[model samples]
Target: MVYKMLVLNIDGTLLQDNGRINKMTREAIEFAQSKDIKVILSTSKNFPAAKRVAKTLKVDNHIVSHQGGYIAKELNKPVYVNKIDEKITSEITTFLESFSCQIKLVHEQFSLGNKVKLPENILAKVVFQRTNRFSYSEQYVDNLSEKLQEGPVSPPKIEAAFDNNANLSDAKKAIEEMYDEVTCIEVGDNKLDIVAAGVSKLNGVKYLCEQHGIKRGEVVAIGAGIDDLPLVQWAGLGVAMGNAPAIVRSAANWNTRTNNDNGVAYMVKEHFRKQYKLEFLKKINVLK
Candidate 1:
């Protein structure tokens, strides 16, 4: 089957440990473009981070960020924004505060509400400090607390990261029980994402398809995290990375090599190249 475009998730799916796009991945994207296949980046990261990746790839297309809470064209032009209403947000915030979970609020603009001061690398460390664990340095704790004090009022998205899986799980359960009005998704073992009801990666993909006049069958969605499950199921060809969790793998139509092993490249080569060749052959026979 031929697909009109490919939708990719960043972080664990596209970038390796060092946060750089691998050479093989770049070549694969170029190969797809050569065949006239559009590549759209769908990520949980904010627009600034996603924009950096898009610039590196040199593709001006749609990006699904905040795990479907936001969709934008290029870096600054927002095509869609799905935010938790203030009532739900306030309730969730109160519930989370009772459990000592620090929250980060992401807004429509690039600005972050509840913006913490620690460097991006030390965010995990800060969480550890809050939990009174040996995991975080004092510097991280100090920075985080300081940032929390200088707050922004309203944000579009909320993220809570914990030091241990048990704590994260407890928080997830607590939120589900206390605030039944919102949707809470576990992104990985250590992080919990709270969003408005009816928001998800699937919604983001559908919105993009509708805006661009592309059909569901024309999309190839790829990812490796739990948050990606909705997208994997929604796309015509749902691909799971070898490194994906068992649940994600089971949800997908096909499993590819791990992202570290250029899994995305392999899929593009196998699917798009064959389609391109068949189309070329058809054109040749028609001309004859």
Candidate 2:
């Protein structure tokens, strides 16, 4: 079968456990691109975070980031962005403040949050450091809700991380129930990502498909994360990593090896080998 697009989730599907793309995975991606398949990264990470990895992989296709709220060709320019309403964002921010967590708002030019304080939890600090190290613009604020309102721009996504899994689950449930206008996705036991209603990695992939005139059946999605389930389920060929959670794996049509085991390469090589042989045979006039 021919695939017009290959949508990969960044954190767990494309990147290995070492937080870098392995040589085999890189070669597989390059091979897919060489075959004229559009390889896109549909991730929950911010544009800069995703762009860094995309550059390393040499994927020139557009990326879907911020959990599908941001679709951009590059970090500097977005083809489309679904930003949360300012009032709704304020309400969500106010609601999340009740929980003991750090809130981060991802904007086009910069990110601002109260969690930038030095005394925040290790996870919060690690997140901040990673963004800073990548040189993604960032700043601090006293009240994110108020500061967000002060500016004309609304963030594409809001993230909250708690120290305890119970509180995080409760907060995620509460937000999902209370904020009916927004979609909440639990990234892990202690974190939740919020985006506009009806927004998701699947939506992002669908948008790209429409723009390119590619049908749903011509797309392949591979991922291993809580937020990746919908995208994986929606693609024509959905593959889940061995390391993916059971739910994610269950959502996929097939399960591949784990990310650390070069799952992306294994799947890609196997999927494209048939097509490659057919083309080679046709070139030699051995097959119609």
> Against the hidden reference, what TM-scores do the models get?
0.79, 0.87
For residues 1-288, write the lDDT of model 1, one tens digit per residue: 567778998877788755678888888888887776778888777666676688788767888877777778754568887687665665665555544455665554433333334335536444221211232112223233344445423444677766567777887887788765568888874778787667777888888788767789878999999999988998999999888999999999989988788888887788787666324645877311
What's the C-alpha lDDT at position 37 in model 1? 72
Cα lDDT tens digits for candidate 2, 1-288? 567788999887898876889999999999888777889999888888888889999987899999999999876678888988888878888887777777888875677777433334546423433565447777767776677668744788988877778887887788788877888888874778889988899998899899988888878899998889888888899999999999989889889999999999999998876665435555888645
Clash count list over all predictions: 0, 0
Candidate 2 positional error at 145, Å: 4.0
Query: What lDDT score is found at residue 10 in candidate 1?
Result: 83
Candidate 2 colliding pairs? none
lDDT of 1: 0.71
Candidates in order have lDDT scores of 0.71, 0.82
- Candidate 1 residues lying further than 4 Å off, grouped into runs, are 100-102, 108-152, 178-181, 277-288
Worst 10 residues of 2 by lDDT: 116-125
